[model samples]
Target: MGWITTTWHRLGSPRWFYGMMAPWQTGFGIAALVLLAVGSVWGLVWAPADYQQGDSFRIIYIHVPTVIVAQSAYMTLGAAGLVLLVWRMKMADVAMVAIVPFGMAMTALGLFTGAVWGRPTWGTWWEWTDARLVSTLILLFLYFGLHALRQAIPAAESAARACAVLAIAGLVNIPIIKYSVEWWTTLHQGSTFSMRRINMPAVMYLPLLVNVIGMYCLFGYVMIARMRTEILRRERDTSWVVELVRRPDVR
Candidate 1:
């Protein structure tokens, strides 16, 4: 508990957080590139074709990861929002800004991938009766709303507060998105890999796991890079930021 508290304190300090994350971000970047390259190649070429869906099912490599990350990212945003709202931490606000774009990207990727997958699997590009699909669509709108609200507010503090409020309020949608299928009679299927047990064959599960891990690493790398940018942007007037920009090596 003590260590966790200290870590959070350090994260609340922009300079401390920036310095600490710099090296980790560099490592994450390299790792993300490697993982993404391997995962994409393996998923695209090496993974065995599905017995039932064949080549069309390959879309799961992209779609599943994007959907997972999209939901997780929103949860992250909400958590960050809570920190900012309760503690009035500027770093949390910066993190919120840094993460929203990636979340939006994930949402877009999921939607596009789902549509592509649907055309081949379901013989239709879309289905309104699919609760998961509809909820995902709603999540995209929620992201847009939060983003727009942040932009409309002029003051950084005010904008952060507004965004935090919006994000916290929006969190109610995530559970609905996750449980939508089970909650209602829907076209979408239930969870594939449950925490309680893995039900699928190893052949299908292996590539899916790889894709998921790679996507997570990629998203973390993106978030770190963007957070650095946000830190610099917010702290433009600070001496550390000015010195960083002026350094020849920084360029």
Candidate 2:
């Protein structure tokens, strides 16, 4: 608890957090690249074709991870919003900004992959009645709403507050998005392999697991990179940021 609180306090200071995260982000950046390469190769070449869907199911390599990250991103945003609302943590606000682009990318990936998968499996590129599809679409709109809100608000503090409010409100859609297939009739299937239960063959699951791990690293890399940029932008007038930017090593 002490460590957690201390870390939180440190993160509240952009200079301290930026200094600490520099090396960590660099490490994750390298890991992200390596994992993405390995996972892509394994999923694309080594994984077996799905018995039901054949080669078309290979899309899962990209689709499943994107879908997973998209949901997780919203949850992260909501958590950040709560922190901002309660503690008024500027770090959390920065976190929310950092997560936006990555979340948007994931949402876009999910939509693209869904369309690609749908073409071969459902004979249509799109479907309106499918709850999962509909919810995912809503998720995309939520990302757009947050992004737009950030831009429209002029003041930094105002932008953070507005984005936090939108994030907290939009959080309601996250659970709905997750449970849409279960709550309503939909073309999308329920999770086949959840953490609570594992029912699939190792051969079929390993590639998915790898892809998921890779995507998680990739998400972290992108989030931290963007966060660093945000820190620099917001702190440009500060002496610490100025000194950091002027460092010989940095240049």
Residue 15 C-alpha lDDT in model 2: 84
Q: Write the per-residue lDDT of candidate 2 for residues 132-198, one digit (tens) a residue.
A: 8988999999999999998998898989998999999999998898888789987776786676986
On residues 229-248, what C-alpha lDDT tens digit does candidate 1 reach at each position? 88888889999989888989
Candidate 1 local lDDT, residue 161? 92
Candidate with top TM-score is 2
Clash number for candidate 2 = 0
Best by lDDT: 2
TM-score of each: 0.95, 0.96
Give the CA lDDT, 0 to 100, for residue 237 in model 1: 100
